[model samples]
Target: MALFLLAFGVWSWLLWPTFLRNILGDEQSWSNGSPTAFLWVHVVIAVVSLVLGTVIGVLGWRAHRANRRS
Candidate 1:
């Protein structure tokens, strides 16, 4: 479970930029309303992803330790 979460977190981080661009209209080359608005959304997502990734990585490490002790 931890390993899976870690992998997913890494994947999310890697794709985050593209996701941000898409939300910001970089992918479609068109804006929904304002670039600033979309940029904020992107920033929020990035922050969430970072937190999630960190948590998952920590979980994976802990799982490894537990396995070693068992």
Candidate 2:
């Protein structure tokens, strides 16, 4: 579980930034010189996922270290 969480976090870290960059660059991401709903929604999702992934990964890492110490 710890390893899984770590891997998930890593994957999120690797994926979200690139995904966001792509989303921002895509013509469909904007409308009339402003960002579209699609862009906003994806931005929100990416931010939430990043926060959750980091928190979960940290918890998992702490648990793993605690287990090892015992």
TM-score, per-candidate, Cα-based: 0.61, 0.90
Q: Write the per-residue lDDT of candidate 2 for residues 1-70, one digit (tens) a residue.
A: 7777778878888988899899899999999999999999999998998998898888778877877899
Tens digits of per-residue lDDT, candidate 1, 3-69, equal 7766776777788767766676564334655456546766797879878877887787688678788
* Clash pairs detected, candidate 2: none
Q: Model 2: residues >4 Å from true position, as ranges?
A: none
In model 2, what is the error at residue 9, expressed in angstroms? Answer: 1.2
RMSD of each: 3.7, 1.0
- Candidate 1 wrong stretches, greater than 4 Å: 17-35
lDDT for model 2 comes to 0.87
